[model samples]
Target: MIVRPRPNWFRMLFVWRGSVLPVILPQLIGTTAFAILVTVLHGRVFAWKIPLNFVPFSLIGLTLAIFLGFRNSTSYARYWEARTLWGTLLNETRALVRQALTLADAPSDVPTLTARLIAFVHALRHQLRTTDAKADLERLLAPQDCARVQAARYKPAMLLLMAGEWLADRRRAGQVPPALVQAMEVPLGRLTEALGGCERIAGTPIPFTYSVIIHRTIYLYCVLLPFGLVDAIGPMTPVIVAFIAYTFFALEALSAEIEEPFGTEPNDLALDAMSAMIEATLREMMGEAQPQQPSGLPPGGFIQS
Candidate 1:
């Protein structure tokens, strides 16, 4: 995600980083040019003066704005929900690792379990982003576990299964009380639920038909708006159309960027930074030095991944 200090109102108008203006600039320019052409023609085609006026456009623009608002709300809901799931995952992992350390009779196994939990976070990050997690798994997991996880189709789920098995083994050996085991299982179940939630958001997107309709409507309105206004507004038609086009096009572009919160887009969630945070917290709990920073993340916690 784009992390920087917020600028004042005056500077905010020109701020480019994390803004969708870059993506929609071309569309805005095209709309402006179309508007200019329509203005030059004065709503005439083949010597025919089309009896168009701004009244119809006013109604269409109002309705289009409402639809765009709804679309943006839907996209932001997905983004916010993804962030909430990750937050829950963070809390659950911390709780599970803490329980394993304090409650287990075989405290020696705490380090290994904590390492697996860390590995699970990285694996889940990679899974949601559709990237390879073999290197991360190898670094954070034992050779046997790492190899097994690498071979599995769903590495995160496999890691969770291993965690459950570890707890089960302890229960069988009478190393931990049944009550403690049950408590530990609670966080594990929560972790599973968070994973499923992320998967659901990643796998399913806002319906394509909504995007198609909104896209068509926004462009159609922008392209035809000049003809409606040229007679009334004269030479200023392109300028007015471009201003209006910016608002509609920018919102559309922004909604597209944030709809998939796991993506590498600048405005998407900072999964790499979050994974690093989980690692740091777990390592601290284990009384170990902080792990080296991951490649994509820079110093001072600016996440580009």
Candidate 2:
């Protein structure tokens, strides 16, 4: 997510910061060479007439537009779902803290509750990244419980159960009245729902058939482009083809990058920064020493959904 005040076209040129180059460079090189070949060999090794009628090309363009539109819509929906889930997590963390501190008998238990809440956030972040949560959990939870919870594959889910147990124990001990517990329970239920929603998007993706169709369509369009313009465009075919290729391929690659917002990619949502925010907010609610605000997200067209 390169965050510039204005769009940075230069970033798209000769930019080797991450994974995009490997995909874009090849398309650029191939498109450039193909354009040159068509120009130099036009009306020589082959007839320079357009391979397909403009009418057929127009139909293909319309079809490609529709497919790309659909792909982007689906991708954006997944990205939005992930962001929305995190938003719910943020509000839920705040609610959980308020409920615990305001309604619980042992206000001293506030710190422990805060710690557990922070750990749950860290656990959720790690779960999304599919990484180990040992250190984070330990920092945010009691040591023994942290080790046990971190050992699980679904750390966030495990943490949720641990949270329920703690709440149940407190209720059984008459620490929290039934009505107050119900308020906390409502938010907890929402958090669980959010968790499932995020997991569903993460685990399931746009159908393979749609992906295959879009990919094939893009390739077919690019490959057919050179032939369509060779007759009229002649020596300019390569330049035109290369530019069109760049436009189409860049859009395709960008859509793929944005489709999965949980990734560590610079362009993806700043989940790490977001988790830190939740931790800071929870700790502040517990009256702990505040951690410094995290760095801002990089400038990009779409950092979040």
Candidate 3:
């Protein structure tokens, strides 16, 4: 994700890094050229006039805009829900660790719990992004624990199970009170719930047929728009068509990019940064040195802005 200060409105017009304009630039150019051709021909096809006017185009454009708006809205909802899940994860992990850290510090339960918590965060992130979690699991987990989690198909769930078993052992050893164990288990349960939510979002996507129909409709609308507008807008059809195409194309591109919020796209959720933050903060809580992230990982926990 591209994080930076919000530019002034005047500068925002040309800001490129975080915008979808670049992604849709090719489509915009093609539509603009096609519009220019239609304009030059005066909505004609070598002496055959294409009978078109703004009437039909107006109705179609309105309907297309509505569809685009609804689609983008749905995509953004997914994006926001994903962010909320991560935020919930950070909170739950912190609560779990905090509860453990306050307990009997003699038997070293804090480190085990903290490692599992952090591992759960990374595992969920990797699973959502469909990336290998071996490096992260090894870096954060003990040999046996890492091996066990690696062997499991669902790593996050495995980590949570390990943590639960750890708590059960703590209670069995009489080091932690039953009441405290039950309280600490709350966060773990919440973590499991959040995991299910993330999995649901990742597994389910915008309907394929809806996406295909909307995609085809948007492009077709843009292509046919020039014919209808050239008859009325005359020489200005290219500019008008380009502007309109830019709007539709940009929205569609943005919707697609953010629809899979767990992706590594520029507009997708900043899972790496977020995971780094969760790890760093938890390490601080456990009094561990803030070590450098492993190779191929981003350095800072904070997203600069």
What TM-score would every model get versus the actual structure?
0.94, 0.88, 0.94
- How does residue 78 of candidate 1 score in lDDT? 98
What lDDT score is found at residue 196 in candidate 2?
Answer: 91
Predicted candidate 1 versus true structure: per-residue lDDT over 199-222, tens digit per residue: 999999999999999999999999
lDDT of 3: 0.87
Best-to-worst order by lDDT is 1, 3, 2
- lDDT of candidate 2 over 1-305, digit per residue (tens): 44334436786565565446567888889877976876676634446354553466678878888888888887888887888888888899899889898879988867766777788878877777788878887777887888778677787887787777778888998999989888888988988998898788778877788778888888888777777777776788888888877777776776788787788775777777777778777888877887765554332212322
Q: Show the colliding residue pairs in model 1.
A: none
Score candidate 3 by TM-score against the native. Answer: 0.94
Q: Which of the numbered candidates is closest to the native, going by highest lDDT? A: 1
Cα lDDT of model 3 by residue, 170-217, tens digit: 888888898898898888899999999999999999998878988999
Span of ten consecutive residues with least summed lDDT in model 2 = 296-305
lDDT of each: 0.89, 0.76, 0.87
